[model samples]
Target: MSEFVSQLSDSLYAVFQSETFVLLNTVDQESGGPTSSAISWVYAVDHSTLRLALDHRSRLVDNIKANPRVTVTVFGQDTIYAINGSATVTQDPLAEVPFKMCCFDVHIDAVRNALFYGAQLVAAPEYAKIYDKRAADKLDSQVFAAMKKA
Candidate 1:
């Protein structure tokens, strides 16, 4: 993997236990471009595991069923990570929450790392700091603890 991918992977591992939300973009079947409809979502991850949950009628879910090829971009305080991978929509309940958790965790980890690695690259240092502060506010410790026990 390239350095970008490695950094993204490690960042994901760090915030997997937190409650940060991710914006998911799916290529439109007709337009073949990313769409903005219902693009935002919450996901969890643990190690290499990823989980996503949505209503049965969600467009993104349908898109994944038809085409597993996906590109997931995660935004951090001072860094952004774009991941290209193949995804499958699974019915396994066990993996869902953990994967979503991991996604948030990784995002936080990435942001913290960016402070040291790319602080000067950001447009506003204060913006990044604000995001870091907000990350803790959104965490659901009870849910996370329950998921781990399962």
Candidate 2:
């Protein structure tokens, strides 16, 4: 079993500053079932808090609104980190973005090193944008810049 900490490590924070593959889990309000979504626009605001931007109409927003409890599984720095937290919708149609987006602020409760015992990850996950490269890059730039701003 792995131990749990109250905040993210320096390595985890750095990785989240850029595009990284992470899985967000939330509870379905009506069914009480777990819902998981792959996301990349995640940023660590600090050791104990994180910010995520998603489409305003995405189901994840609805789930989070219904239940704030969430778990974000971060895959980077040669290990997997399961970060449990409670999230609040900080912004809808976040300012400075061309399209409608929602921002979520997550207060971390616990962080666990979920990598299997005695094993190390050889590589982290990678992804390619399926849409127009120029458009995607522009959108990401705008979103991340807004996220970093105070």
Candidate 3:
């Protein structure tokens, strides 16, 4: 197996336990270009798949239906992890939550430590420090913790 595939079962979702949000990249249907956006609600359904919440009118939602392949990257204070996966749209993820929301079940295919490459293979704190002050406002602390358990 490849290094990226090896990392999948080990530390893929380990680092994301504390992360509130991550950068989501969806391919544009017409242009076939990647569009980056910060998704506030995302959680791991299991070790292999992550559930991503997308707004009803979100372009990302449409993009995913057109193309299930995508990437979700998390930049933390000391590490950066990216997951390359395939997404499937799940309608009405949460009944309590208002509005029409679409959920994407992303099956993680590969994982990479973007900012952590060196002689010793350690995370570069310098790169992480840049995003220190940023936080996802819509993040639910309880839900984040719950997913980790699930």
Candidate 4:
């Protein structure tokens, strides 16, 4: 919807890949105060949406139900992509404890470039490889393992 959103798809993808953890910021359900959690269970559903698979025990799920407003901050190469969106939770059962999963359907509202020097930094030749490795080695490992079991 904004230049920040339109132009940053590739850049955001890179960040999403390399970053082992993204900061999920949400407000407290009752107090309406800010809270942030380092999460590794999120992925882009599309350009305008993201899906997060989180355990029901997290307060983040409750916060989303109370107020869908959320901001996901991804980082790498000293660059930050803070994606603003709303969330929709869906119940998904798991074999492990806490059998419920909150699959958040984030609707993109804005993109804030959290950067230094007023823009992005120069990327290295191995940046893409780094991205790929992080995606498979860290982020997707859980999902892949689950698929293998299935």
Please say which candidate is ahead in TM-score: 2 or 3.
2
lDDT of each: 0.46, 0.88, 0.66, 0.66
Provide C-alpha RMSD values for all models, in order: 8.0, 1.3, 5.4, 6.3
- Taking the tens digit of each residue's C-alpha lDDT, what string does model 4 give over 1-150? 224653237656555443356789999998889999977766665577766766778888889889999998777565667788888754344333234555677788888776655676565223233467765565356652332232
- Model 4: CA > 4 A from native: 1-3, 6-8, 17-19, 92-98, 116-150
How close is every model to the real structure, measured as TM-score? 0.52, 0.93, 0.69, 0.68
lDDT of 2 at 77: 76
Which sections of candidate 2 miss by over 4 Å?
Answer: none
Candidate 4 — what's its lDDT? Answer: 0.66
Please write out the lDDT profile of model 2 over residues 8-57, one tens digit for every residue. 88888888877887999999877889999999889999999999988877
Q: Judged by lDDT relative to the true structure, which candidate is superior, 2 or 3?
A: 2
Cand. 3 TM to true fold:
0.69
User: Which stretches of model 3 miss by more than 4 angstroms?
Assistant: 6-14, 92-94, 119-150
Better of 1 and 2 by TM-score: 2
The collision pairs in model 2 are none
